[model samples]
Target: MQKDIELSGKLGKKRGNTKSKDCKTKTLILGCVVEKPATVGEIFKRTGFTGTYKSLAGMIRTYHDYGYLYRSGNKPFTYTISELGLEHLENPRLAREALIERRQANAVAVTRRFLLGMDEESRNNFLTEMGIQPVEQHVTIAKNEPAKPDKVTVKVLPEPVEKAKNEIKTNTRTEYVSRPEDLELIRELEEMLASVKEENENMARELAGRTIAKAENSTKKPPKVRNYDELLIRCKDTVVGSSFFNEVPYNLYVVIAELTKASMKELLKEKLDDVLGKKDFKKGRIVLVSDVQASALLRYKFVRKLKEEEYEKIKPKVEFRSDGVYIVVDRLHFADRMCDLPQIQRKSTPIIHHS
Candidate 1:
């Protein structure tokens, strides 16, 4: 008998847990849109929600009817939680209790209707299964109250059945009654759902066309080689000069100086006599004083390993400015190595200023 009691306790606890989860359905739906507006698809993708899309959409529509959610566009309508919805999320006890009460009342109404539609024998069997004594037994027990105790063995209705009866008595509440405005909102929601369906079909066609185009382009073009070391060697060998003076560009030293935390002038201060050495430029510098000065004018980041697609099309190019000469490389390269920079905000400098 103790084992039976334990088993029943476990079953009852499982049922209660399920009931608790069911009561929080509205609260879960409202929580999904508390941070930002989201379509049903986006909410599922972001939250890893496992419910059916149609069921979620229906709940959102109901919340909108209650003014707990705001619906934005018609194309796959996005939902945002309203201020009232936020209030409900923070203190959901009252709302959850009311929902559970309404559900219980609705369940009783449905069961009563089903019993009324059944034959007498079927109705008796249904009530017996639910542990409810038939209506005839109630009459019999009242009549036999003064008789022997053995005759009063007919069981009384269980607690759930008694509760169901009380709920049915108070089931006249009209909280879910549809007003004219609600009907209008329902029509609009239906229209928006239909529009979303049409848009999805169009997007499918567009995606198929793009896939075919991509395949054809892939067949026409051969993939380019992307060797980081080879590119680095070529970039290092890049020389920039006029007929009057030809030499390796000074911009490379500027990049090395920036990496080593030394200024361009400091790096070249010892090497002045090597090429455009200091003797030629008044200072013992190999290049012009103007060129050395130009290198330190503007702050910029150096590009390292390029992404495959960028490597295929982009070649190293030198850009000249009044203040400095710098190399322009693929954006992805700079993005990949940006973390190495001491100040991350200096990742990229905007070349153009718009007023």
Candidate 2:
């Protein structure tokens, strides 16, 4: 049956797209998958005008034409990664060393030429665009030769200077009750500059506080407005752990963003576990979880549009917000879903979605 063959081919490509590839192809695939979908033609363009890229594109196109790469419902007609493509990825490339050298040299060139002029965020964006990332970010403190700490001296009071003491007794606390004429005559100018300085400082502080408050209030958006479930799903796929282990069947992400959007503080109900065999995972959405913290998390997902079975596809049990959420994940994996509401619940508070 042509239809069956086509379906199998499409399934195979999908498997490849999801699973295996050479370094460059993986990078290109990841670039497309995380941010947006792409076609074989687009991938060839990204590889630059090279024979290797054209050859690869030709192969991919052939595969697609053969129905090995089927497009999903309203999704782009993209080729999935196939077992054969995956096998190629595991092979050692003859130009591996040369490619590494070129990449390193190019990185240096970028840092010296373009990156120097860019701001921090722009530089990071550039790195991402280039399919590279900064090795590490660090701040160095200028260590001047160590200075000795300040020394404090105690004054022995110079034996209380008997003459000074007597003079103080005589000169101190002049009891001139109601000497208005003397006070008037003794006037020298006393500047009110200190009081003026204090008033200015107070004014500046008040103005700054008001400005910050206004900005914070205006910028914050309501967490209740967006679909929290979709947010979690997006966060999960892209969130590879600090280290990724495919042997582990669970889709463990380094960060869980549902917590950020769901401020359901009353209950912590996001609990998930891989109890069933990975094959049985499809039918068993109800999981027995070990993490009690996840149980206390609130449920915050907008699945009104999703079919009931589709909703159960993800075992999104977690302790949202309260704890056990990953703080950093690859940015491309987590698409920036913006909040459209003008003003959020009064302040920029973090939401810990539990259920």
TM-score computed on alpha carbons, candidate 2:
0.16
Q: Over the full model, what C-alpha lDDT does candidate 2 score relative to the true structure?
A: 0.35
Best by TM-score: 1
Instruction: Write the residue-wise lDDT of candidate 2 on 1-355 in tens digits.
Output: 0111111112242445332334444334333322222345344444442335445555556644533342321111334444333443344242356567556655544444565588888865775576543322332222332222331222222245775664542333221122344234323111233343455568679999999987889866323211223444334434333122111112321212232323433222221221211111122122221111222221233111223443244323322343323323232232221112211233356899999
Q: Which stretches of candidate 2 lie over 4 Å from their true place?
A: 1-37, 51-58, 65-70, 73-76, 91-355
Per-model TM-score, in order, reads 0.25, 0.16
Candidate 1, residues 163-193: lDDT per residue as tens digits? 6565543332212122445456545644655
Best by lDDT, which number? 1
Name the lDDT of candidate 1: 0.44
